[model samples]
Target: MNAYGSYVEFDRARWAALRSRTPLRLSEEELQRIKGLNDKISLQEVEEIYIPLTRLINLKVRAAQYLDEVTSAFLGCEPVHKPFIIGVAGSVAVGKSTVARLLQTLLSRWEHHPTVDLVTTDGFLYPTRVLEEKGLMARKGFPESYDTKKLLDFLTRVRAGERQVEAPVYSHVTYDVLPDRSEIVDSPDILIVEGVNVLQVSKGQPVFVSDFFDFSVYIDAEEQEIRNWYIDRFLLLHRTAFRDPSSYFHRYAELTEREAVERATNIWETINLLNLNENILPTRGRADLVLSKGPDHQIHRVFLKDL
Candidate 1:
């Protein structure tokens, strides 16, 4: 229906020309890190989109903190504290992960905040064993494949002003959950929660993973472009990470190039694309902002609902 499969049509050049008043600063080191993911990281996009976004979120967080302080003072509390949670959601291979990581670094560097942390919803996915037990391997990214209750519990604890909470970590190399290990979610000035279905709303459930978010973002792109990106990233991984003996997907590396690409395409068409259409796409409207990307993978425009 639109360039990015959204109902809205946009012109990249015109949108890029819309001057943003937010300050954006990135050192060479920061640029290099972003380039590692894709060499096409433009300072203009960062300035026009992410910078304004960070400033808006910063203001919201500050307002939230102030209101919290007033409420605490009214109740005669000793201290007021809680991390601001920002949720990033999108289809697979939409580069939302890179955005989350970048924002975590950039926002933390702001003089107003001392710490920022990035946490992913991947860790909340049910383990391979559990998935197999429930016969949900084919539906891995589907809502039913996740431990929604545990995810809700973890978020509730995080929202309750808990000082520390542990989230399980998933190892792509091992293709399994690291049962004995966990990442400490120490309190921070802000927490970036990034994942495909983090913004999903299950109609039947009274609880949802997105309830914990203070702000949410949806990274949007056309389905064909997303599928293409997924295939390209898979091919890249096949040449690099999948070549490692420790890589769980190494089995595919032994195949001929044609075979490997075929398998990757099948997986993308069947699993990832299906999940995106059925589960993730429905949540775009729920985000506080939607970052619409062009076919070339650069952002075309941003849509923020009226406050």
Candidate 2:
């Protein structure tokens, strides 16, 4: 191990060299469909970076299954089936959604053809009314802003082999949890859970969101880079989704470009930056893998948790 005791680091060239004979399973079109707003990842990057990363994850999944069987056999008990859970964490606009989606697509193409599911922890955030009542509207992405009990219960049921589990759905257009609807996740072979706070530990909570993860990843970027990405994304939303009459940010559509940018900068500075510095950044070392990105938003290094 290097001086970073927990992880052995690899630069892009070395990390990309870890790619085995695993063939690329995704096309550029499919990748474009899954790519997040303002996050640019070329097909070449997928081949060099993500494909190799997915291969590593596949190895871990197989190892985990073997351990499960061996442990069950040693205990002379029947093995209970459980999905391999992956936690993907990062700051807002750090391209975590893209990573989660890409992994889901690639992992599903493995020889075993394991069923994969993707869920974002945004769905677990408390409703706007609830946040308003608690006077936490401005502190929205913090740990306390989530309905921790509900999220914990959902994961508990998933790990318990419960089928047809339903989770609340949050809409970006509405910017709130949909009261009348939820998204159902049947028992899957793999579940990718992504969010800004997936790796966070709550002080009084008995179970952390990461406790259920078989493997976890933290997407890393400098604070200023993330801040710029967030503002850029905000501007993009203003021109597109924010222009919709039903959008929560529709009012922003009318602002001058300068005003919109100013507002986005303010939100990033006051809200997202605070959450990242105080909560998200502190949890980076806890991840099983860390993908550090350059200012261009391309992953430049990998840090694998050393056994």
- Candidate 1: Cα lDDT at 252: 80
Relative to the unseen true structure, what is the Cα RMSD of model 2? 1.5
User: What is candidate 1's local distance difference test score?
Assistant: 0.80
Scored against the true structure, residue 47 in model 1 reaches a CA lDDT of 70
lDDT tens digits by residue: candidate 2, 1-307: 6543589899988888888778998898999999999988998899889989899889888888788899999999998878899999999999999999999999999865379999999999999999999999999999999998899999999998799999899999999999998988888889999999999987777889899999999999989899889989999998899999999999899999999999999999899999999999999989999999999999988899988
TM-score of 2: 0.96
TM-scores for candidates 1 onward, in order: 0.91, 0.96
Pairs in steric clash, model 1: none
Q: Tell me the TM-score of model 1.
A: 0.91
Name the 10 consecutive residues with the lowest summed lDDT in model 2. 1-10
Q: Tens digits of per-residue lDDT for model 1 on 1-307?
A: 4433434433555444443554566875776676434325577667766676787788888888888888889999865468889999999888987889778866886776668888788888899999999999999978898888988888887777687799889897887788998888777888888889998887789877788899999998889988888877887888888889999898887777788789889999899989998999988888887888888888877776545
